[model samples]
Target: MNTVEAPIDIATEEQSIEVKTDNSAENESTNDTSNLDKTEPVPIDVPENPEKIEIARLSSIITNQTNEISDLNARLAACQQHYETLLNRQKEENSREKQSTVMRYAQAEKAKLDSDKRCEALATKNNDLLKEKDNLQVKLSEFKLMNTKLQNAYEHKLSELVALKKELEKTKEINQSIDASLKSTLNHLKGESSHLKEQRESNERLKRDLNEQHELNEQLKLQYKQLTEAARAIPTDDEQAQALDTLRNEHNALKGKLTNIQDENKLLREKLKSSDEDRLALENVIENFRQTTMREKETTKKLYDDLLAAREQDSVEISRLKQIESLSNQTLADNADLRQLLEKEHQLLELTQKLTEKNSILQSDYEQLQLLHKGTSTDFECIQKINEEQKSQIAKLENIEKSLRDQLKELDEKYQTVNKLYEQSAKQYDDSLSEIQTLKKKHQANTKDLIKQLQQLQKPKFTNNSNEHGPMLLTSPTKPIANKENSNDNSSSHGSPTGSFSSLNEITSLAVPGSDHIPRHTPAHQQQQQQQQQQQLLLDEEQEVIVNIVDIDRQKLIDKLLKQQKLLVRRNEKIEFLNDHIQLLTQDLQNKRKIIQTYAMNEDSFMYTSTESDSIKQQLANKNRNNSSSLMATLYNRATTTVNHTTNKLFEQSSPMTLETALDVMGKLQSVLEDTLLKNITLKENVDTLNKKMPIVKSASTMSESTTNEAREALDCLHELSQLLNTGLDKKTLTACVRLLEAGVHPDALAQIVQVLRSETRTTKL
Candidate 1:
């Protein structure tokens, strides 16, 4: 009996330990399950002692913490509002400042306009002074020429005076000779001496008139000296004064016009000095205007730079706002999803609580059946009592088994339901995750595209800003907010409050692990559920991490896209600018071509005229050569004839001379004539040769002109063809044409037509 009792005791103790272990394992599983649930609260086992009271106290502490979190959230909302308000105020202030800057710029522009007007006026005055100076220079040159002529005239007059003085001396010498002769006659005849005295008296009167003419010459010399002194004192110089003197002398004899010439010279000198002063003043004014205009231009550039900076800042701020709005919307969506997950978890918790309550009732029934079996066993005989106790125990055990079976069935059904719900939730979560991923991918793509566009737009602006305003400081406050990490604990704690409250009682029931003494099915099922819950929790955590990663990736993608877009935009702008530049260059090239064409036409015309002139010159040279040849030929013939005549005369004069001598002289004359004739014919032949080359040269020039005209016509036709092609093609076709043209096709349209034919052939073959 001791051995049997010992085995039974060992079995009972082992069973009890196993039960305790199951309860402890269930409690541990519940804690892990609750942690993994993300929404359901963990159930605590209530004790019949002070431990239960401690749990209540702990519950109150959690409630207070929740209230604090709520208050913090409200405070955070208020702070966000305040920050938004400050941003708005700053924006308004910036706008006001921008307006003030614009006003200042306007004032500066007005000042610039006034300065420009002044500059224009100064330029006009300078131009007028330049004209006056040019006029003065012309007059001064004319005066110099006049002065030169006057000096020449004065030299001629002095030479004439010297010649007149010499003539007077000769006449005086003749009078002296006549006087000597008269004295001698008086000695010869005393009566004739008286008549000679009367003649001598008449000569004395003629000498007195000559002395009066000499006195007039001395007065003219005195006037010339006075004019020279006046000319020296005036700024016009003696040369101009000499010019005036010659003019006055032409109208009046020298004594009457010296004072008038001096006065005119003084007036010219005064006017020249005034003109010089005016020119100097105008130059100074022009210099001042140039300096002021330079300053105004600098100021205008500064204002333009500031305006560009302001506009860029505004664009950046607007972009930031849009990003912030997108992030806020994403956060709201995440919160809604989290709320739904929490509600589902709360429902699962309530079902678990109901299963635990059913287990507790089955445990109570099993204990009562054991008590009744114990009490009946002491009142009966061995076999009968054994039988009755067995029967009653068997019935009670059967009822308890049935109840356990019923509870087991209910637990299994609930387990299945919970499992189904979990599977559905997981599926839903997976679907949501897939949808979110898809949306994220699409959003990333779209964001990348948008960023690219924005970047493209901003690049030129940024480059322009950098060029215009040097370096700029850019501040982005939204970057910090967007990059902030979400706390995992906070995300788990903020469950749907309404769902938690509705399932509060069920949560309390699940706290007692051993209150239901059913078989260990619930523990095993709960363990499986806990594992599933942990897996779901892990998935949720992974999804959160994935979401965060996706967000970061998306943001990175957006940034990359933006950068690409900016690069593309900048490239596009550069391409457009290059195209514009190319267009301008083409226009310039066309203008140059036109200029070249005009030059070619002019050159051709000039060459034609020159060729004609050369022909005329050749003709003139030919005529001159012919005239010279003819004159030489006639002279040669005349000489030949004269030689022959002389030879014949010589022969007649000396008939006795030998026949060989006369014949030799005739032969020499003939040879001389032949040589002269040969020289004349050679000159004539050279002139004829030159004349023949002139027509060939003219014909060559005409051929060259014709070639040039043909080349010009070809270019014009090519240009017309290009214009027709441009008009015939749309943008896409034009682009194709351009590509074809670049590829060296003479006619882009022909190349396109060929391509179309090839494509059609291919299609027909297909």
Candidate 2:
């Protein structure tokens, strides 16, 4: 009954251990199931509730297996402990019995040796005694000496025995101490064995638990693999199928979005192309407009220039009319002075006639007195005839004197008229001299102003020097020679003095002779008349010379005025044309500016859209990366669990009793664990590398998108600017106006227009 009860107690203990192991394994299985729940994909074929049932069933089985394994491990540990304790006790008993038998045999052998030594000594001693008695009897006389020798030897032998006995006692005590130490050692060994048995039991429990956990993991892994395979092989449930369909639909939708994006890109490209074309057209139009504006400006300038020229011409004509009126007044005054002188000459002629009549009456009275004296005297007839002839002669002489006096008076009047004409001519010459002086002052001021302008322009001094010298060379030498020749001719004409008027004596002599031979009237009168006519002819010639000089001066003034007026007109026209052209250009510039602003706004909008698209793409990529990482983590966990399960199965398949095989398997497992750790480290390093690079990739992507947008905006702006330029060009054409001005129509205005055209052409080229 006690034996049965003991077996029952052992069984009960085992069951309790199993129960505990079952609880621990159940907890572990629950943990693994929870992890699986977190990682596992939704079952494709099974219903949601069915998956829960299957998980519960797997947990229950795992718990049962763990309990059985724990019980077996507990039993194995208890049996090994009992066997080791029995072996230790048997070894201790056998050693004690062997030690006792060896000790008894050694004692018996020592006793036997001692007995043999004593018998040998007694036999030798008996022989020696008998020999000694005989020797004593023989040598009764040396008996005392021999007795002393025997006594000394006996004493030495006794001392030797005492020492040997002490040695034996010490050896016996040492052997007893050795037996006590052996007993103590045996007790310690027994205690150690018991401790080892307890430790082995604990290790067995741990191993059993580990085995159970491994088994449970294997079952779970197998179930999961099976489920996964089934999910993959079998058709999914309606809901799962619907989810897959939705995913497919999403993929198709994404593709459609991509296609739409491509289409938008194509549209953008087309828009860009159209914008470029529009830019080109606008540029052409702008060029034309600019040209036309220039032409209109040139035409307006020409008209203005012509008007100014006409006005200047009118002004010049007015000035000429004023000069002519002044000259005519001066001539009329000179003619009046001449007419007064002629009237005085007429009065002198009448006075001379009255004087001639008185002189004739006196001559007749004298002749009559002479004739009466002649008639009374002897030769009265001859005296009377002589007195009559004397009277007749006297009368003729008075008539001649009267005629001479009249001729002299006419000559004096003619000289007076000539002198008056000369005075008038001198006054006119003085006026001309003053006018020339004024002209000279004006010319000097103009020359100085020209020189200042030339200096401002930095004109070469060589050209100015050449111009001054060229005119000097052309006029100076010839003018000096001509002046000297004229002076020489004047001196020669004066030296002759034949036509020169002498003092009043020559005048009297010439007048007296003419008066005396007056022929009493007719011949002297006719000769005086011819002289007066000659003086009048000379006066008329002088007046004609003055008229010719005045005409020449007037013509020159007219020409100069016409030229100046024309120049002023052209300059004014050019200024007006330039103003109009500038106004047109300003309008064109304003239009171009507005177009550029619109283009800039559009470019900004495009940039915003591009930025948004880039952001969306970045978000999508990040989402895809996160999903991939989660999937990899799930797969890695499943693989690790499966590997652990596989190792447990391999251990179970091997024989536990074969220590060498177990050791080999343990070494392999150690190597495999090391390899797994290395792989884990490598994977962790890879993940760290990816994590470190993520910011850089994001920054690069953002930069690329920004650059692309900036480039597109720049291109658009350039296109718009080109379009504006083309539009401006299309609005005007200036070439025809330029050509018209090129002709001599408005030369000064034309020159200005040419300059403007050149500048515009350069700008367009640029």
Candidate 3:
């Protein structure tokens, strides 16, 4: 192979050098003739001067030389044509073998290249499918999480609805109880007010008359006491009689005071009992509040946990997407490496095939030369012609080498410029890549912060549960009223009137009615004066006692009313809080579901905003709370009629779709994955088929060392030849029309260019 390739290389170099020498010699002869033409122009008229005649001779010699140069140029052109004809004949003899070998090798190389490209494409497609599958899986997981979150939210809303129903029931019962209590209280107050007004008039009249009677009785008692003292000194019948009459009046006054006190005590006892019942009811209400607050706390904890889990799942899904992206990048890089390896292998195989063909050709040529060596003497002259042709071929080959070297130098300069441009592009790409990384990191950090904010938002809020049953007035006087009444009756019925009177006198004061004539100077007068002062003090004390009893009864009624009012207010506050909480939760659920739905729908939109959550809360609050209770009641009544009409519309409008919709999405994803998997399998099969059909089975390692080196050299030469031919064809393809309309035999520039292009394509394939 080396011997054959070496001779071809030497022949091409010699041919280029000979062409250059012939061209240079022709150029020198033309230049000398032109100089002669300029210095010694042919005289248009015959000149008889000796000098002119000498000039004419010189011009003739120059003309002869010019003719000679022209003849030589024509001879050179004939020789070149002859050499080309001989070469064409020789090429024709070997053209079929060389073309078949080259075509076979080129076809095999093209087949290998096409197969490798198909395999590379298939591999890229498979990688894309795998990447898509991974992306779908991540989406599937995210969708599942979204579905779960939606389900949890649905259940939570249901629970809230149930709780609200219960609360509504409780509120209704409370309202009923309050209505009943208020009605009863109103009636009682009405009766009490009317009766109290009547009692006030009677009491005022009784107090005035009783004060007059008491005063009269006191005056009489004072007189009787004096009469008794006088009677004690001297037994007077008239004084004794007067004293008994005064005692009778005093006894009557005492009876009236005792009856008034008994009535007041009875009313007080009833009020105390009512207060006790109210206190018990209020205690029960407070206990219920505590129980409800505990339930709310538990519900809040569950909601927080669900939210946390959803966030974690979202983060995991994002991480999975990142991993899929990285894996796809790796697959692309691996594909690029495979393509480079395939190209190198194709080059090695092509060079090896070329070496084998060259070695066989060289062996055949050696045998032909050996046979021709023993021919005629004329054969020696043919050998000399062949030798001259060989020298010209060597010169031509040298010129080709020189041209190739110049092309290489120009290509190197171009390559250096291209390398600089490539470096600049690489730097720009790196900067852009870094910017993308920084942006990604910033986005991640923002997402993390948003997640943290969401977590904070998810934290349970403490509902203020005020223990409002604290104002319990436990002043129920439970003394035995019946026993006291019996004892009082027995005391009034059995005890001697005067004996009781004497006993009552020690404990009470006698009031004087209209005795303003009593002197303060006399002992009796002073005694009467002191008794009147004492009686006045007793009347004031009794009046205050009567007032206190009425106040106590009214105070008990007011306390009950206040307690009921407080309970109603407290209950209203609690229900309002619950309603507000439910509304807030509903809004939050909607916002979260919207975020989840958005995240699930668009894989690229990773940045979900919690700020919108607050907006949703506000919107719902404004929407729900704008209507008062009356408006809400009206709307509720309208809902039944509108429900059927709006249900489908609302369902469609719902941003977070139902579990069924989510499930449908999952089904679609699975179907897509299955389709992708099927395509991937088909692609893999095609790649396998391509691999099976690829040629060049034995690798470079199977060839002998000498053959491998020769092949490497042949590969290098072939690569150079292809490059040279491609450049030469590109430059000279327009030099002549292959089908000339004139007499000149047109050069087959177009056909040769086509051949050169085909060979170049084959070399590139190799």
Candidate 4:
């Protein structure tokens, strides 16, 4: 009966301990549920869709926590009922075994003390759980704050988008206005062009009239010179009078021709005035078009910039969202880790239950031994020492678990920081790549536009130059046909013209009765006709020479333009190569930085090249500020200088430089640069190999630093040059100057020629 009472007491104590543990778990779950419920909601006056989703998630989390807590409470209540039942059974046993009640009571007190110690341990565990829950609550609060910030950012983005839309609408209106202006200008230009064509025809006719007047003046001068010579040989007063009559008749004919020439001159002057007015109108229209195009370009650039800014903002927001998601995931992981810890604690409770069962078995064995040999008190004290050792071991394990948990938290934080850094780096890389692609596309488009503009500009110049040659081109085919017709008519026409001249001479002779030189004067008139025919032949030859000179000049201009285009293409290629190199260098630097960061993150886990890492970091920092831009600029400068040197050298060797020769020279230079690039790449590989083979970190670091610095400087130079390239060189007048320079023209000569061309263009425009 006493033994049964002892077993009942042990069972009651075990049940009480189980109930205590369940109550502790219930308390912990309750605390977690309360913390979840107490989590602050995002402070928003007007919640959007995202806010609603977040609120729903939070509510779900609270409900889940509550349900878990309720389950724990139920478990605890069941444990409490079991403990009560066990306690009643022990009380009944105590009543039945009254003889050994005092010993059983002492054993019960010991069990109670053990149970109290375990309850204290459980309370500490519950406190740790509460602390974890508090940490979770803090994280939730931080998440909520982040959400609020994101919402604010979202609202700001929406506002910005709306503003952008308004700007777009305004731009559309402005574009419409520009289009309308363009259409009006185009119509105006069309009218001007038609008027110019009519004026051109009038000018051509006036030129013919002026040529005729000039021939008449030459003929009159020759006749006067002949008459003065003949006057010296006058034989009598009658002959002089006859000469006077003949001179008077020639003077009358000259006066009538002069009057006709003056009328033509007046018409030419009136046409000139009309043309001047038309030119001024056209200039105004051109100015208006230029202004409108400039405004359009400005608006388009503003829109592009705004779009890029918006894209960047979106990317930033996406990065932020990703960061938030990572943080939330980390929190969930931590929660999972906490759940695992709780599960382990539950497992420990089961182990403790098993140990208690074994303790009960040992106690029963000790009781049997005490009954067999009444001196087992020392053995019981030994069992107590063993139990104390187990308790110490359990305490050490708990301490180790706490240390492990702290380490896990540290590792998690480090991982999160590293992840953030990696993400930021990747984002920057992607943005850079995207920006580069866009810039390349823009460059191509701009180049195409420039080419088209150059072609358009060239067309007008060609047309203007060709206008002077138009009549020559047209007359070239008709001249032979007219000459053939003239040859066929010459027999009949010549006889008729001679007979008329003879008849006029007779009439003049009869009218001047006592003249002896009338026949001689008829022969002199014939001589004048032969001289006029000779002058006509000379004029035709002079016109041909003028046409040849014009053709030569046109050819030279075309060749120069072609050379400049080739040079521009080579320059563009060089720029593209430099850009690619910069991108590659940037990628390499990013990769190295990533590696260094990873090394730094896992410093304890692996050996790291500290010197190399430090050098790389220094290089990166320098590149970020000014070195990169300077490096790019220097590299571009070097390439351009090399091209200039090569071109000059080739220009000297080839006295008559052709387009093909210039193109070949440029290709050679490009190849040389490519070879140099390849050599540099090979050298880099060799250095890397050497570094791998031998730990010459200082040397490697020094080399890398130098290379990085140079690269940075080149980048800077390239950026500055690209800016200049974009801003400068828009004027059509500059094309000739650029072409001359590219064609290896002497600067002084080029300047003079450009000035002359510019003046000529200005005159023409006027």
Candidate 5:
């Protein structure tokens, strides 16, 4: 009876445990609904003749099963705690993954921003390069125009020089003829002067002879007079008659000699008159020759002055040629610089491409990180679901077998779907990769074509330059030869014009801006020919140097461009290789992620499946024992369920409310409150300032009417004045009004002045 009572006491205790389990089951999640039906109490039968040994065996068995149940419950509790810890760890890992992903995303964004900035900078650089190219092109056009003009000017100067040379030759011929004629005239004049001197000496000798003959005639007349007187005194004798006869003969002979002498004297006087006339005519001819020579000298001097002026013009042309050479050199340097800038632009483009590729890679990495973060989050959720399932498994051990099979079917279906998705993704990835390869090949082909086109385009330019320069180079040497010939001819022809020519040369040399002048020798006339030859040689050398420098610069630029092109190609190849590498890495990362996901899913499925089998076995064993000890088994299950439910609830509620979490939340709230307080203080200060200004505003508005009216009137007048000023008033009138206003004249006075000015203007118009 006591044993039977003991069973009844056990039944009452079982009733209390069942009531507790019912309470716990009600508190548990809806997942345990199927197990709730099994918690109902089964009626117990007490035997009238109960055996002590049987009761003892039953009690002992119940005690042993209860101990096993308690142990299993403890183990389940430990597993639940471990699962909770694992969930917490998983959550922390997910949060950390989230943080890392966010950082990676931020880094990617920063890189994108940097790339954008670089692109903008490159765009600006491209614009600047374009502007420079335009400016250089304009400069080149100007240089071409200048070159054409210079060529025309040079041709004109050459024509002028030829004309001058012809004129100089004509003048030289004229001068030579004039000099010969003058020599002939001078010789004739000298012969005529000598004839005149001889004639005069003959005339003087004739005059002296006539004077002697006159004195002898006078002495004879005196002797004849004395003889006549003596004859008158002596009378007539025969001897005296003979003497008179002799005297008469002598008288007749003397008279005959005197008559001949007088005729000769008359002839001499006539000869003297003729000689005087010839002398006067010769003197007049000499004066005429002198006048002609003076005129010829003046004409020659004018011709020389013209030649010197032409030389000065030639010197100016030479200076201009120097300027052209300098400009050409500058243009060549500019072209080289432009080429370098173009190469830099190409490099910048390559850099931009590389940056774009890197940005794409970073974007991919950021996406991958995001996917990983998502995967972790999903894994965490799955783990939480698994933990919840584990708790439900503990609570509803009876239905675990059925639920496990369905869950396995679901998991299998999910795995199949995941596999299908992975396969599809792999196929897509392969297709994309193939497309990328094809695109790369096309791009490479296009780049090759473009390079060929560039080379083709450049060939024409180089060929044209070579063709043009060939003629210029050929022509250049001939220019100095021609110039030297001209100088030699000028030096040979220009004898008497040396002083004026030298002075003109000095002036021309000085007129050459920025040209270094060689100091002139004292005997410049002697050195002129040597200096001309030297100048010709210098000009030839300078031209050769210019041509060579241009050619060298062109070749250097071409070489540099080619080298830069090759470098760019190499860099492009490297970029392509790096891009391929990046693609491969990205593919590998994706594969790794897929692999990790597969591993996680497999682990979850294996864990879930393994637990399902154990739970099912346990349920089977419990079912077997239910026939013999249903009441005890029910009580044990109730007790275990209650403990598990209570523990799970406590852990689930406590997990999010740790000391650290509470502190973090409190700190956030405190910061928010502080921000709000600061905002409120700022608002209050703004309101106070507004309030303080309100009174002042009101007081000003409440000012005396007379002053306010005056102020308003002044403002109106100013506004009207502004409008009038804008209405096309003449500057003088406007300035006068401004001055009147500045001098503190009233608006009325200014207005009256303006009206008067307007009236005056109207009157003038009328």
Candidate 6:
């Protein structure tokens, strides 16, 4: 009975240990654990009996097995500690990995942001370059226009110069004719001067004869006095009386002769006064001629200097034009360089995109590795638990076999749970990688197509000016979208098969106010699940930045197109303006020509009226003579052509035409002007309608250019006509000049034709 009790006690203690193990998992208090440790060395009962050797053998076997169990338990405890340490280390490693991943993600985000900034800057630069190119194109067009205008102007000037040379030659001929006429007039005046001088000499001789006659008259008077005295002294006799009477008669006769001499002298004095006046008039005429010659010399010198200066200015302008051409060539080279640089930047952008994709892939792989490590560790822990349960069951096979089986099932379930988690993580990672690769491929294709499209769409611009402002750019209006669509558009904008719509939709679908991905009412378990799911779907900061960048780029495309449309509209407006200007100029020319014709038709009556008005003008001129230059005034005073002034005044009058006729002409002219203006308005309306219906931008631009050239030509012809009018033209030249308006010729063209005719005239005359 004692031996049986000893075995029973040992069996009881072993059962306690198993019970403690079962309870230890639920109640892992230190007090409970210490109590379990204290129970490790329990006393066993021993009794000496006849089967002592069997008892000893049983005791030894039990002791050895106990030692073996303790050793195994110690090994198991060490293993459990080692596994716990491994778990702790793995947890720490996973946390470090997460931190590192987050850090890497932050760094990538920063890099992406920096790259985006660079891309934005590059895009701005590209836009600026495009604007510069447009401005350059505009400037080049302007320069070409200026060059054409200058060429036209130069041609006009050359024609005018030729015409002026002809006019100058004609003027010289007229001057020579005037000089010949003046010489003849001077000769006539000289003959009159000589005749006046002869008259003066005759008057002086008559005066000298008159003085001698006066002396004779005085001498006769003295002789008469002496005879009277002798008569008075010896006069009483008839002979003396007769002698006195004879002397008195002789004195009376001498006095009569003296009176006749005095009358002749008085006549001579009046004649001499007239001769002196004639001589003074001739002297004044000679003085005026000298002053006129001097003024003509100064005018000739000034003209020569102006011609030389104009030649110098032309040469300078030509040089300046050559320099401008060189600058344009340089601008072309700069534009080519800019294009190459843009291509390089585009390549860089592509490479950066690829790098970002690779980084994201690397991050996904690291995450997969963490999941694999956790799954393997969980499986290892489950296998160790199964071995521990097996060892415990072997030690208490009779008591705990069923419990161990239950534990094995639990262990298997945990292993399956860990395995499923790993599979899910791996599957998710693979899906994400596949999506990334597909996106990259799509984006690459889209980029290639976009590049090709851009190359095809690129056009030459006009001006070289970099500072020019382009047409305004307007963005499309924004709209909301579903959360799912927002995500889809984001991905599609960067990586869709149909990139155009995707890109366009990205702007409209930028923000989703409410999303399913956001967690709602959550239990602890559900909250945990939601957290895990959120972690899975959450994008890194870098990816968010990339999406924003793509959206911005899409918007830029829309803006660029809007700018182009605005430019087209502006070009049409310019064309219309040029056409309107041309119409106004043509109408003006017509009105001026009509006025010239009207003036010509009434020239005779105008001249007669002008002559009638001259007397008043002469009085006014005399009043203002002090204000006028004495040089010309004195010359006019000494002029020998008194018949010209008396016959007809050369000065024009205020009423050069009759009031009624003028009013009628003016009213008709006004009506014609109104009609022309109406026609211009109708033409402008037609042009506006055509432009609105189908504005041919290039053709409109060309038409404007041509119209501008025509207007410049017209202006040149008008200028030449005005210059010719200023010069006192003969009737034939005036007729020819006025005939320029007969045909609807451009001013420059008319100038050319007139120049040719004048050349012929000069050649024939030569």
Candidate lDDT values, in order: 0.49, 0.50, 0.54, 0.54, 0.53, 0.53
lDDT of 3 by residue, 336-429 (tens): 8677767766565655345344535633543333332233334445655876797699779868977997798689769966975686577568
Please write out the lDDT profile of model 6 over residues 1-766, one tens digit for every residue: 2222433554575576567565644454554455446544444654556377566556765675576568657855875565445434434443454455445543454445446666666666666666766676676677667767667766776686677678668766865776576556555545655564565576568668667866876876687678668767864678766766876786687678668767865765565456446545643553455445456556666766766766676676577567656655655666676566556555554443443343344333333334334434444456558767875775687347558767976896698669756865775687569656866776676566655654554433323423222110001112212343456555764553434444444433342222234443444433343333222222222233345434435575577568756865786687579758967996898699669857865564224443223323333333344455433223223323222234333323532334664365345445545665688799999999887867577778889999999999888767776877755445765664455344333455445434433433432332
Estimated TM-score for each candidate: 0.14, 0.14, 0.20, 0.25, 0.22, 0.21
TM-score between candidate 3 and the true structure: 0.20
The worst-scoring run of ten residues by lDDT in candidate 4 lies at 635-644
Clashes of 6: 13
lDDT for each residue of candidate 5 in 1-766, tens digit (9 for 90 to 100): 2222433554575576567556644544342343334323323665555576466656765675576568657755765565445434433443354445434433443444445566566666666666766676676677667667766766686686678678768866875776566456445544544564565566567667657756765775676677677778768688877877877787688678768767866765665556456545644554465455556557667766765765675576567557556655655665565566555554454443333333333333332233334334444557678877886775686367558867976897699669756865775687569656865675566556655654554442322332334333333444545554455345534343233433443443433321224343333432443334344444433333322222323475477568756865786697679768967996898699769857875674435554333333333433345446532222222212212233323223322334754465345445545675699899999999999999998887877666889999899868967955865568866765565454344676456445544533432342
Off-target runs (Cα >4 Å) in candidate 6 are: 1-138, 153-171, 236-317, 325-766
- How many angstroms is residue 365 displaced in model 6 relative to the true structure, after the best TM-score fit? 62
Tens digit of per-residue lDDT, candidate 4, span 1-766: 3444566666677877777787777787787767666654545664568777777877878787788779777977886677556544443343344324323433443344445555566566656656766676676677667667766866786687678678768876875786576556555545655665576577578668768866876786687677767777765477766866777686688678768767865775675567557545644654555555556567667766766765675576567557656655655665665556555554444443333333343334332322322233344446558767976997798689779977986897699669756865775687569656865675566556655654554442323332344334333433543443343244224334233333433343243332233243354443433333333333333323322222324475477568756865786697679768967996898699769857755564213434223323323433342433432122212212212233323213333335764465445445545675698899999998997867678778889999999999788656644543554343654553454344344455444334333433333454
Candidate 1 residue pairs in backbone clash = 44-511, 45-511, 360-516, 451-562, 452-565, 455-566, 456-565, 456-566
lDDT of 6: 0.53
Tens digits of per-residue lDDT for model 2, 699-720: 9999999999999978765664
lDDT agreement of model 4 with the native? 0.54
Per-residue C-alpha lDDT of model 1 across residues 1-766, encoded as one tens digit per residue: 2222433554575576567557655765675566446434434754568666657666865775576568656755765565445434333343354345434433443344445555566556556655756675675576566556655765665576567557657755754665465344334333323433453465456457546645766665577667667767766666866766775564365334445545654664464455346434533543454454455456556655655654565565556556545655655565565555455544443443333333333233322233333433333235445656766876798679779877986897689668756865775687579757976786576556655654554433332332212111111212321222223333334433223322432332242233234343444544433333333333333334433433334475577557756765776687579768967986897699769857874563324443223333333433444456432122212211211233323213322334664365345445645675699899999999999999999999999999999999788657845764645444654554444444334564344343443332332332
Backbone clash pairs for candidate 5 read none
What clash count does candidate 4 reach?
20
After aligning candidate 4 to the native by TM-score, how far in Å is the CA of 529 from where it should be?
93
RMSD of each: 67.1, 88.6, 53.6, 46.5, 46.8, 56.8
Candidate 3 weakest ten by summed lDDT = 469-478
Backbone-clash count (model 5): 0
Local lDDT at 354 for model 2: 34
